[model samples]
Target: MSDAYLVRYVGGPLDGRVDTLPGLPDEPRETVTHVHLHGGPKIVHHYDLHYALEYGCEYRLREAEERDLAQD
Candidate 1:
Protein backbone atom coordinates (compact mmCIF):
# COMPACT_ATOMS: atom_id res chain seq x y z
CA MET A 1 0.00 0.00 0.00
CA SER A 2 1.09 3.56 -0.67
CA ASP A 3 1.99 5.82 2.17
CA ALA A 4 -0.63 8.29 3.27
CA TYR A 5 0.46 11.88 3.75
CA LEU A 6 -1.31 14.88 5.20
CA VAL A 7 -2.83 17.33 2.75
CA ARG A 8 -3.41 20.73 4.29
CA TYR A 9 -5.95 22.95 2.58
CA VAL A 10 -5.32 26.64 2.99
CA GLY A 11 -7.97 29.27 2.31
CA GLY A 12 -11.41 28.61 0.83
CA PRO A 13 -14.09 26.62 2.66
CA LEU A 14 -11.86 23.76 3.67
CA ASP A 15 -9.15 25.92 5.07
CA GLY A 16 -7.25 24.53 8.08
CA ARG A 17 -8.52 21.02 7.43
CA VAL A 18 -5.86 18.39 6.98
CA ASP A 19 -6.82 15.24 5.09
CA THR A 20 -4.85 12.05 4.70
CA LEU A 21 -4.21 11.25 1.06
CA PRO A 22 -2.35 8.29 -0.36
CA GLY A 23 0.17 9.10 -3.05
CA LEU A 24 3.82 9.51 -3.87
CA PRO A 25 5.89 12.55 -3.05
CA ASP A 26 6.76 13.10 -6.66
CA GLU A 27 3.20 13.65 -7.75
CA PRO A 28 2.50 16.66 -9.92
CA ARG A 29 1.14 19.89 -8.54
CA GLU A 30 -2.39 19.71 -9.84
CA THR A 31 -5.67 21.21 -8.87
CA VAL A 32 -7.35 19.64 -5.86
CA THR A 33 -11.12 19.51 -6.14
CA HIS A 34 -13.29 19.22 -3.04
CA VAL A 35 -17.04 18.75 -3.28
CA HIS A 36 -19.19 20.28 -0.58
CA LEU A 37 -22.76 19.15 0.00
CA HIS A 38 -25.09 20.80 2.48
CA GLY A 39 -28.70 20.23 1.41
CA GLY A 40 -28.15 22.16 -1.79
CA PRO A 41 -26.36 21.82 -5.09
CA LYS A 42 -22.95 20.28 -4.73
CA ILE A 43 -20.20 22.89 -4.65
CA VAL A 44 -16.73 22.11 -5.88
CA HIS A 45 -13.71 23.95 -4.54
CA HIS A 46 -10.54 23.93 -6.56
CA TYR A 47 -7.18 24.41 -4.86
CA ASP A 48 -3.84 24.90 -6.50
CA LEU A 49 -1.00 22.86 -5.12
CA HIS A 50 1.74 25.12 -3.84
CA TYR A 51 4.43 23.67 -1.58
CA ALA A 52 5.50 20.23 -0.46
CA LEU A 53 6.45 19.73 3.12
CA GLU A 54 8.30 16.94 4.84
CA TYR A 55 5.12 15.10 5.82
CA GLY A 56 2.45 16.95 3.89
CA CYS A 57 1.55 19.21 1.02
CA GLU A 58 0.10 22.71 0.93
CA TYR A 59 -2.72 23.67 -1.41
CA ARG A 60 -3.99 27.21 -1.78
CA LEU A 61 -7.36 28.32 -3.05
CA ARG A 62 -7.38 29.16 -6.69
CA GLU A 63 -8.44 32.59 -7.86
CA ALA A 64 -12.19 33.16 -8.20
CA GLU A 65 -11.94 33.68 -11.93
CA GLU A 66 -10.09 30.39 -12.37
CA ARG A 67 -12.70 28.31 -10.58
CA ASP A 68 -14.97 26.03 -12.53
CA LEU A 69 -18.03 26.73 -10.34
CA ALA A 70 -19.02 29.86 -8.51
CA GLN A 71 -19.99 29.98 -4.86
CA ASP A 72 -23.49 31.06 -3.93
Candidate 2:
Protein backbone atom coordinates (compact mmCIF):
# COMPACT_ATOMS: atom_id res chain seq x y z
CA MET A 1 0.00 0.00 0.00
CA SER A 2 1.20 3.49 -0.79
CA ASP A 3 2.03 5.55 2.29
CA ALA A 4 0.77 9.10 2.90
CA TYR A 5 2.34 11.98 4.78
CA LEU A 6 1.41 15.43 6.17
CA VAL A 7 3.74 18.40 5.73
CA ARG A 8 3.45 21.02 8.46
CA TYR A 9 5.01 24.45 8.74
CA VAL A 10 7.06 24.98 11.88
CA GLY A 11 7.57 28.73 12.06
CA GLY A 12 6.91 31.91 10.06
CA PRO A 13 3.74 33.46 8.74
CA LEU A 14 2.55 29.99 7.76
CA ASP A 15 3.68 28.42 10.98
CA GLY A 16 1.49 25.84 12.76
CA ARG A 17 -0.27 25.21 9.47
CA VAL A 18 -0.11 22.08 7.32
CA ASP A 19 0.32 22.16 3.57
CA THR A 20 -2.25 20.02 1.79
CA LEU A 21 -0.32 18.87 -1.21
CA PRO A 22 -1.45 16.64 -4.03
CA GLY A 23 1.45 14.39 -3.16
CA LEU A 24 4.38 14.74 -0.85
CA PRO A 25 7.71 13.81 -2.36
CA ASP A 26 11.38 14.69 -2.02
CA GLU A 27 10.97 17.36 -4.71
CA PRO A 28 10.33 19.98 -2.05
CA ARG A 29 13.67 19.25 -0.42
CA GLU A 30 15.44 19.59 -3.75
CA THR A 31 13.79 22.94 -4.37
CA VAL A 32 14.56 24.18 -0.88
CA THR A 33 18.18 23.14 -1.23
CA HIS A 34 18.50 24.95 -4.52
CA VAL A 35 16.95 28.09 -3.10
CA HIS A 36 19.19 27.96 -0.03
CA LEU A 37 22.27 27.70 -2.22
CA HIS A 38 21.15 30.87 -4.02
CA GLY A 39 20.32 32.75 -0.79
CA GLY A 40 16.83 31.95 0.46
CA PRO A 41 15.22 30.99 3.73
CA LYS A 42 18.28 30.13 5.81
CA ILE A 43 16.38 27.91 8.26
CA VAL A 44 14.21 25.99 5.85
CA HIS A 45 12.03 23.38 7.53
CA HIS A 46 11.84 20.25 5.47
CA TYR A 47 8.54 18.49 5.10
CA ASP A 48 7.88 15.96 7.82
CA LEU A 49 6.62 12.58 6.70
CA HIS A 50 4.07 11.25 9.16
CA TYR A 51 3.45 7.67 8.06
CA ALA A 52 -0.30 7.26 7.39
CA LEU A 53 -0.03 3.47 7.00
CA GLU A 54 1.56 2.79 10.35
CA TYR A 55 -1.75 1.52 11.80
CA GLY A 56 -3.60 1.07 8.52
CA CYS A 57 -4.15 -2.63 8.96
CA GLU A 58 -5.67 -2.19 12.38
CA TYR A 59 -8.13 0.37 11.01
CA ARG A 60 -9.15 -1.87 8.10
CA LEU A 61 -9.56 -4.86 10.37
CA ARG A 62 -11.66 -2.85 12.79
CA GLU A 63 -14.03 -1.79 10.06
CA ALA A 64 -14.28 -5.28 8.58
CA GLU A 65 -14.79 -6.90 11.97
CA GLU A 66 -17.48 -4.38 12.85
CA ARG A 67 -19.36 -5.19 9.70
CA ASP A 68 -19.03 -8.94 10.29
CA LEU A 69 -20.18 -8.58 13.89
CA ALA A 70 -23.22 -6.57 12.84
CA GLN A 71 -24.29 -9.37 10.46
CA ASP A 72 -23.90 -11.98 13.19
Candidate topping lDDT: 1
lDDT of 1 by residue, 1-72 (tens): 767898888998989998886765577467778889999899878899888877888899988876745544
TM-score of each: 0.65, 0.30
lDDT tens per residue, model 2, 24-48: 4544432111013335645322333
Which residue pairs of candidate 2 clash? none
Q: Residue 60 of model 2: what lDDT?
A: 13
lDDT of model 2 at residue 14?
A: 43
The lDDT per prediction is 0.81, 0.35
Error of 1 at 44 (Å): 1.0
Q: For model 2, state the Cα shift of residue 70 in Å.
A: 61
- The numbered model that scores best in TM-score is 1
Q: Which ten residues in a row have the lowest lDDT in candidate 2?
A: 54-63
